[model samples]
Target chain A: MVTAKLLGLVFFTCSLEYFSLPHLAHRLFPAWSYLLSAIVLWFIPIPLLIWLPVISVIASSCFFTRRFNGGADSVMFWVGLLLALTYTTADSKTHFSVISVMTIGFVGAFAYFMAGVSKLLSPQWRTGETFQWSLSQTCFSETFPILRQHSRCLSLGILLWQLSFPLALTHRYLAIFYIVSGLVFHIVNARVLGLSRFTLAFSCFYPAILFLSHSGDH
Target chain B: MVIMAIKGLIFNKRTLPLDLLRLFFTSWSFFDRPGDSFRTRLTLYQDATPILEQNWPETVSFKWWQLIFNPAGNDWHYSKQLESCAAILSQKYPSEDFLQSREFKQYLNHILKYVGPKSFDTISVLLEVKKYSANADFQRLVFLTLPTTNKKTFI
Candidate 1:
């Protein structure tokens, strides 16, 4: 359930950061935005995290489609949906939670799969020159400017990301390691590369991933 | 761990989830043109100061998170506009009126009001469109500054 709670917390934090800011005070009523603070209050690892409030936040986000910024926003969308799948039957936590974790894993893998496929199919990507072009951009400061310039590194990155999903589905310990590695990867992307939101948005799934991996050990 | 996973897949032969992921990966690999990753450009100049762009102060005053989830919130619309404008500009060179578009002005105002310094009355934006060509020449399109004197909702 740690994953469940973390999902909610990440969702709440994203909303708080983007939706409930004083900068948006005039647009979204301060009271309404302030009310989101309740989700923050309720983000504890309790058994019965309500779906309604999560739904409200998700709905508000959907209503404001202008806000969809990146893959991180897409991650928030999945977490919001998955939050609804949480069931409260007293039989066992593993039953629904396993399915929930698996579903998140599925979604996560699908995203990476598509990304890898798209890149593989592109001529620029195949030649690794696209990586060079992207890395060579004269835009904001890139985290790995020197590394990015090298097509081999970029190509290897693509291979690892696209190929790693199947590995995560294998053994319990291996899966945990894979997911944790994913977290580290995202952290580097965020901290060094400056793609900040990916850190939280992508890492929210690690709890589920870790739980699922651990479950098979028992 | 490796042995166990291999065993499950081999013995059980019913790794539906994993198989589906495999399928997803295989399917995506087929169509490989240029994948769009929301790589667009937005520039803001307060008299001569660029805000939140590459040419801004070299040290980068804000943190990574600040740059990613910027307070300005300009990426969404700015990106969409760039997409359509790229489509249009690729076919024909943009008109002077379109370059000085109302949408363009509104975006400028947004940057000035939210991100730019209030002290400077004159601000301008130079939008660079990337690769509007089918041949993938990495087409570059940019225009002169759309100047704004004050924040009072340009008339």
Candidate 2:
């Protein structure tokens, strides 16, 4: 389980590299100025550390809200803002920090909702049989020839897992199950199909989910 | 037999000073850029006297300028310079013993082919030279080989 969680973290790190982070950071900060500001921030002594996260969150939010100016950039900017907020709130002790954490959970649920809806709308994914065949071709066709023998079982399991993802968003326990299953899907794909890099890109939601659950326990 | 010959030539007491001078001249010519004044100086020397007189102390400042300014021009001039050096060396040391060794001839042929008309035939020539030298110090010679015959065609 620890290995699985570490694998999931690896995926999240990779996803940040490939996805919106590079463009978003570049857009928010002018290159040299950002480097200068970061250096200045780094040298600020002990007392500033406590406020640094909040200040950064506020600065990022203001930058995104102003610069985004309503297009795909705006959407990416706000998403980046929310990620920053979650990161900052995770470290805070405020009463509303729990709300911030729960909002992060909703963000993960939103991903599942988008994925499940897309799968449902796609005729190929709905058939479940085709999903299995495609999954096998993608994940298991290269290794473990024995997986071919269990093709029917594999196909049905993937379909059921994806189909139930939206429903899982409603309950905390169900959300955990969906998150675990999503992680397993990536791990199986990586191990069997050598799609480790691809799997890492899809695991970005795990941080949000884990943050929410930890905050909820508190 | 080839290894023994190179070892003998390298260590020959009477030839040691000339060899060092040759090595310095060869390495400088091997690494020089086209149109560099040093390259011009090299061609004027019948012996190593002009090379020794014109040799500038190696400095980071000169290297930086050589890299950033007139990079392409320097490359071409250097190849011509190296070819002249090899031709001069072959003329000066025309003993059958020196020319007979397959390795020496191979090195000569490699230098000749590299500095010849087909110098710019392909990118691999530059890559091969870099690989052969095991030193990026000589990479400037690559730019010297860029074909000038069809600049308008390329552009």
Candidate 3:
């Protein structure tokens, strides 16, 4: 089951990147001829249906070019590659064993520590009000601008919640609160601010899966 | 009037430089003696400006680009400028001892609001500047500090 799920994730990611290669290459490669060729290749619908390797070739080329540029582009390319590679090899028993577990653990721990440290350093965050204000401003402001008036109180509430996030690791109730608050936060962001991409990509579905997947085993 | 304008420059601005300065000052304020804060300094300057009018030189001007970028290519120059600006502002408001007061905290908070937020590295630079300079005046310029990270990468 795990192997099938891992393969599914890999295939999905690869297909997405492949399908999006022309758009990605257009942004990376300014040369008109190269762009034209990429577009033509992308539009070759029948071939794409028959063979997946072609998509990989085009995507890899675009990735290499962008990654070599050494800037924001490179960082994005590397992160994308990391995500792709992780998904692709997730089912391989050798790859998924100790290394994968360690990597995920480190990433999870680091993310938690970063959140805690950021809160600790900021006085507003320490006081717990800033979180509430931030949530209202970034999450709830658009759909309900009236909430903007209570930004201070909202920000304080958010701060308190975030400050308590680290506690979730040790306590089940705290963990549940963190997850609930996080889901609410993302839902509000999607519903109010129209930031569906962020909500989908970082907040709601992904983190929930991670939390649930890890909670039982580790 | 010039002193007031200078003080305003230190406080207002929604741009990256102002944000960096706010981070720099806030981090410094954490380790500072309870009395010395950005708010205290600003109020002191506001209250003392009338009296310091004669001493406020008409020729007082800074190389504005220095606030935007460090021409010396050294981060140390940036730190020096921050300290210098704070010192100059403090000197202008000598009467109130703006270096130590609750108003200074307000000033820091106001700057924080305008500057908003920053990532980890920016925070580190602010903390570094604070550690290097014990005086409040020097720390104010910390906002003018720029990110040392290569910008080409999409962080």
Candidate 4:
């Protein structure tokens, strides 16, 4: 229920922002569609109305393919869908919750691991030129000039951290460490790259990570 | 989706379903390397002379609100679209056919609306790709150009 609410809030925030912008919204759906979706999202906390928001999110994601916002949006959809499914199998709640958690956990872990591997494969990242070049291109270059000095070291550290992200699931302490590290990483990314949505979108998975890490205890 | 991803990776073929599924698990290869950044320019011509010239990022404001909302104008999205178009043009078809292709036409329509041009006789798009060197020296190449045409097809 907490995860669903957080996902709802995140969707509400994104949908409101997306639909409110006339230039962005009208290109895809009409104003009424956005309004209706927003209202449904607003009422997601209602026990009976949970499925409506999940459907809305999935539909919105499919409809806005060309204008797809980011991976975070998709993550929300998958997580929301699995969460909605969990509500359906009320008889086997424990088993279903485990399934949902494992699904989300595996997907989330793969994302981080894939990101790290992608960087590892990239020539620029391997040589440590990617960070310096990437940062130089962004608006942060002038303001955070000091980052350029140790760009290589910073890039290597980031690469290793991302590569080892899945190991967080092995131990509760490690999971806590990665969760905090990820939060800080996303916060920095939000500021440096203007990807604020990522911070909230990715943060939604932390709860699942915590659940899985602590699953063995109970 | 996982199966589709593995298939797409091996075959390099993607359907709409696969694309929609990809949003959930994108392999998160965004900016894996210092990738080539693309700048898109749209010029509306009235009578063989330029009337209004618009460039993305130049015309698109980098507002703080964009961090949470209105991310379509974000650098990554725009760059990815142009980069995809360039890749397709380079790999498969001729440039002229590609310009008339539905995929390209739809992209033009969307960008034109985003640019908010009123009216024009001919509108052309110039896609410039920035390539960076090890020494940080960069060069810009006109990667794609849609020759000026009075085609009402775009609008």
- Index of the highest-lDDT prediction: 4
lDDT of each: 0.49, 0.36, 0.33, 0.62
Compared with the true structure, what per-residue lDDT tens digits does model 1 show for residues B16-124?
4443333223333422343432233445556577643432112223464553344332233333444444435434646676546644444444444444444454444
True-structure lDDT of candidate 3 = 0.33
Give the local distance difference test score of model 2.
Answer: 0.36
Can you rank all candidates by lDDT, best first? 4, 1, 2, 3
Error of 2 at A118 (Å): 2.4
lDDT of 4 by residue, A1-218 (tens): 55665676577666565554544422233223334544554554444655765555545555443344567667777776677666665456368756876677667777788899999998788777888766644433234667777888888988999999998777789889999999889777766665667777777777787777787445
Model 4 misplacement above 4 A: A25-42, A45-48, A65-67, A91-94, A136-143, A216-218, B1-15, B45-51, B59-67, B70-76, B87-92, B117-122, B131-155
Q: Residue B66: error of model 2 in Å?
A: 44
Q: Docking quality tier of candidate 4?
A: acceptable
Please compute the TM-score of chain B alone for each predicted structure, in the order given.
0.39, 0.24, 0.20, 0.59
Candidate 2: segments with Cα more than 4 A from true spot: A1-80, A87-97, A132-153, A166-176, A198-204, A210-218, B1-155
Count of residue pairs whose backbone atoms collide, per candidate: 3, 11, 37, 0
Residue-level lDDT of model 3, residues B1-155, one tens digit each, is 23432433443433435333332222211111112222112111222232111111111122322222211211122222233345445545652564443333333332232223322122111211232225434243222222322221111
DockQ, cand. 3: 0.02
Docking class of 1: incorrect
Q: Name the 10 consecutive residues with the lowest summed lDDT in model 1 chain A.
A: A22-31
Model 1, A14-123: lDDT tens digits are 55555533322122422243245345335543345445444443333333222333455456556655645654333485677557667776676666667776776676
Q: lDDT tens string, model 2, A1-218?
A: 22123322332332232233231222222222223323323343123332432233223224321122111122222233344454456555775545654554565455445555555555544444343444332211244556656755665565456556555445567557777788777666545533344244335455556655554555
